[model samples]
Target: MLYGSTYPRDIFAELNRLQRELEQSFDIEPSIRGIGRGGFPALNVGSTPQSVELYAFAPGLDPAKIEVNLERGVLTIAGERTDQPGTPAQQATVHLNERFHGRFKRVVSLPDDVDPDGVSAVYQNGVLHISVRRQQAAQPRRIDVH
Candidate 1:
């Protein structure tokens, strides 16, 4: 008589092998917050009763290079980091390089009550501060019965 393999043995072995491979290759992608070209800078956002504030720590950039736009209850900040601070030779010896340099854009969703018309931004001391006033219609009002 001819010798042959059993039914359950081959199937079980194959399934086990596949499980092992999947477990070995299992990896999770890192979650990125905010928007940017490569490495995004940290942003601090705060909201008050009458306005919303946003601060971004962006050094080596000018006020002209940055552009702010608000549309459809969304705020977008886009700018390019030009390498004009140091000489080419000086930049070659950077030890701990943590600064981000490139074209970057960050978009934030504004609240329905925010007034897009009264948005403003200012850059100072390597920080960009933005203030958005809330619309009058969105403010809570007390009503009295006549």
Candidate 2:
């Protein structure tokens, strides 16, 4: 231990704190795919001219238990993962447990022009995919003029 010296771990923790502060000051919503906040089921969001696509990467989860909803231009995904059998049992010596096992929820704001009734969700190969189609009037159209 030395005076006026900072440890590497402390420096990184401080940097993370500063980043969170800056995001709050700028009203920047943290993404569900970022670290430090422990957002479960890391997400990938993208959009096309026709629809908005979102993918949640969650392995070892039952597709029937996942819930997806869209209301008032907002999308919500929530579910729970049961604990595995490796828990501290009478003869089990657990060393490292890094997997997420619990209830998790994520919400995303959608564009105003999205059609609420045109949303669809499907879970396959441990990934949950949700698509929200844009309104008809919001899509670009070709116009001919003299």
Candidate 3:
């Protein structure tokens, strides 16, 4: 390793960190169907002229177990993913374990245009979908050419 040289891995890590920070700080992702704040149960956000929608993926859990809350313009999704039936015995050897089971949380800062009072959440097929209407002032309108 050269004294003044930087490794490629270091550069990639730094870039990823900066991108994550931008996404969190601005509450905007590269795309609506893109990965969100690094955490369990990733989400995708999309916006239309009338409202903004959020989709959170959390499979294999009952809807009743998931908690959704909005406070001070921030949306929070929290819950736990527990081991299911036919669980492996304690003495069983595990070759690969990719599932995440336990408590998880994700706080998404809502855009200023969203109306907190108009927010609604619905969980179906292991996905929690939420929608918040845009304020009248924030909606885009076409103006007549004068």
Q: List all candidate RMSDs to the true structure.
A: 16.1, 8.7, 10.6
> What is the Cα root-mean-square deviation between model 3 and the actual structure?
10.6
Per-candidate TM-score against the hidden true structure: 0.63, 0.66, 0.66
In candidate 3, the residue pairs with backbone N, CA or C atoms under 3 Å apart (3 or more residues apart, or in different chains) clash, namely none
Model 2 C-alpha RMSD vs. true structure (Å) is: 8.7
Candidate 3 minimal-lDDT segment of 10 residues = 29-38
Write model 1 residue lDDT over 43-138, tens digit each, in one string. 788999889999988887878989899999988787767546675436675433334455566788889999878898999998999999998774
- The deviation in Å at residue 2 for candidate 1 is 62
Where is model 1 more than 4 Å wrong at Cα? 1-39, 85-96, 138-146
State how far residue 61 of model 3 sits from its true place (Å).
1.2
Better of 1 and 3 by TM-score: 3
Provide the global lDDT of candidate 2 against the true structure: 0.74
Q: What 10-residue stretch in candidate 1 is worst by lDDT?
A: 28-37
lDDT of 2 by residue, 1-53 (tens): 33332434465555544554465457555444333343667888899989999
Runs in model 3 lying further than 4 Å from the true structure: 1-38, 89-91, 138-146
Model 3 agreement with the true structure over 1-146: per-residue lDDT tens digits: 22332434455445545654465457553332223444567788889978989999888877888888888888888776777766652446654344556566777888888888998889888788999898888458899998
- lDDT, candidates in the order shown: 0.69, 0.74, 0.71
